[model samples]
Target: MILKRLIFALLIIFSFTSCTSDDDASTPDRRSIEDLETDFQALNLQQGINDVTLENLNGSSWNFRVIIPESASSTERPLVLTLHGAAGGDVDAHKNTACYAEPGFAALDPIIVSPNGGTQLWNSAFNQDLVIGLMYLTQKYLNVDRDRTVVTGYSNGGNGSWFYAEIYPEIFTASIPMASSYSTFSSNGSVRTIETPLYVIHGENDELFPLAETQEWVAATRDAGTNVTLEVAPGLTHYESCNYSPYLQNAASWLQDEVWD
Candidate 1:
């Protein structure tokens, strides 16, 4: 009789422990925003570009560049994850390709991070998880305004912006994808309803990805109740990457005034 009673008690304890573990897994991080800001201030990071390498959850090392504005302080500032194009360049070259490290973006007073796309494109599962891990690491070391975090990219990176917004809506407040297409998600049948607002910028005369296709995708996404806007640049080509900076700056302004505000 005592053996049976002991077995029953063990089962009850195991059930309660399992329930507790499940609930704890679903609970949100209990750290306050102030605590995060304090931790960032402790870093004493200088105002300029810094090269950083962090290990992802999969034990792979990822290289990225961070641009800290002069105005950064203990107060939480907006974070912009600027993905680079898949042009087979190093992180330094990629950061400059899309004007992400330019003065224009710095004027917005947001901490910009540009990550190098590894052997695969940003839409790949490995790269996607790497991006997520980068964000988490950034949050750990920087005073990021979680409500105003943004994801923006150019060309291949632009496709990634859309992918992250669609797959991780809860992490980003908005996305700005420039000179990109919907091929990645559409081809994989991964298109779904996205709540994060999107500001898409594509050249009207884009030679690689047709402008019409982006318009069609935007229309479909809008019809599905997504807060999305498409801005077409006239006489702009795919290779005119630097020229897109002004348009991206405009989009950033819109995000500030419309979404973050």
Candidate 2:
């Protein structure tokens, strides 16, 4: 009878051990923030543009340019995710002319990332997911100041900026959308109130997306209680993308002094 009791006790112990093992197998280990920062520092990324190709969360490949500032190692800097226009080829060239690369934006000492949108429009669900995944991955490896993150883009990329800021208000603090139309995302001429501030830059004589319509939409959005600012370039056209740099500098200044401050 003692042996029978011993066997029953062994069976119970075995069942308990099996259950513990099963629970352990189901739970995944999460690394601490300090550990993640240590891993990022270990990479020893150089100051300047680093061409990186990372696998997206969806198992697809994404090519992007990361511009690390000189003070990145010592200080936690703001992150700027700049998207290129629809004519997306050679992300490096796009980065060269974009406003974030200009001297004014550089003075902010922020880490800038320019991602290749490929042939697809940035407003599409697939590409939007890719943007979110990329931003998260960037945060995982870089010392990013979450409160000062900005999303800015041009033309089709501007459309993406608006869409992303609207959809993921918790991620971005401010948005600068240049040469874009609000009607692209909000077809019914309605603007959803979002917490992220918007600084829109558009050419006064935009041939493709009418400036008048954009002005109307901006007015309506302001009336709807969104913190928005619009800058109209006097004589610029939609295709003269390079000329928008000066305007972008103003937007960057506004972001640094007014919005982020």
Candidate 3:
């Protein structure tokens, strides 16, 4: 049953995810393509993304994707900011199946934002205020739960994934980093001891970085007595392993639908 489930999840991650881009479609979908362009212009409460111009502290103009949720009510939903891998700075990929966060996160409709690294690396690597700018924007435009904010990513973004979680543990309720090593504070591990909840995923058969790197990352948080969860996929490579839908399903299940009281 586990094997069958893994196969089904792999299929969804590869093909069955709900998001797609013109660059992703099997063929040129003129009608849906045109509709998408038109829809981007017409924004409703159903939630959409907005392009923002931001200048990092180092004077680099950072491109940002501010993803809103579907027609939500009562109060605004939580806010989650996603980072991308070194080669995958484009936000559209995150909005699509790869990151499993789109215009709509099914469980909880939070304000999701994805920031493009100015130079194939996070602003932190550039000694800038990009992340702080993100915090400012989150506070400025939305009424966040404060304790419910989340940071998640994979690979290069996975490095940034733990960066935010470590630096600002007070802001994030939970963090998930898939298929990336976690030592962000230089040669030493300073922020590894925060008490925030974390969900980590990786493949035992991953060839990118040894399983030890991921295990070390988790050990930091665990040694600090934080609420951390880790999952090791079997018989999968690094890229496709983290891309599996079941891993995303597990992540979404842990992250969404939490009451911030």
The candidate maximizing TM-score is 2
Separate clash counts for every candidate: 0, 0, 1
Q: Is candidate 1 or candidate 2 better by TM-score?
A: 2
- On lDDT, the leading prediction is 2
The Cα local distance difference test for each model comes to 0.72, 0.73, 0.59
Candidate 3 lDDT score at position 126: 38
Provide the TM-score for each candidate, comma-separated: 0.77, 0.78, 0.68
TM-score of candidate 3 versus the correct structure, residues matched by position: 0.68
Alpha-carbon runs more than 4 Å astray in model 3 = 1-46, 55-59, 72-74, 87-99, 123-128, 184-192, 256-261
**Per-residue lDDT of model 2, residues 1-261, tens digit only:** 322332343344334323444556566543333443354345456788777665433335567778888898998998888878875455554455344344537667898888787777886655665566556656656777877888988888888888878867777889999999875226665566757899999999999999998898778778788899999999999988778888888988998899999
lDDT of 1 at 86: 67
Question: Which residue pairs show backbone clashes in model 3?
Answer: 46-70
Q: List model 1 lDDT by residue over 102-130, tens digit each.
A: 64455568888788886678876566655
Rank the models by lDDT, top first: 2, 1, 3
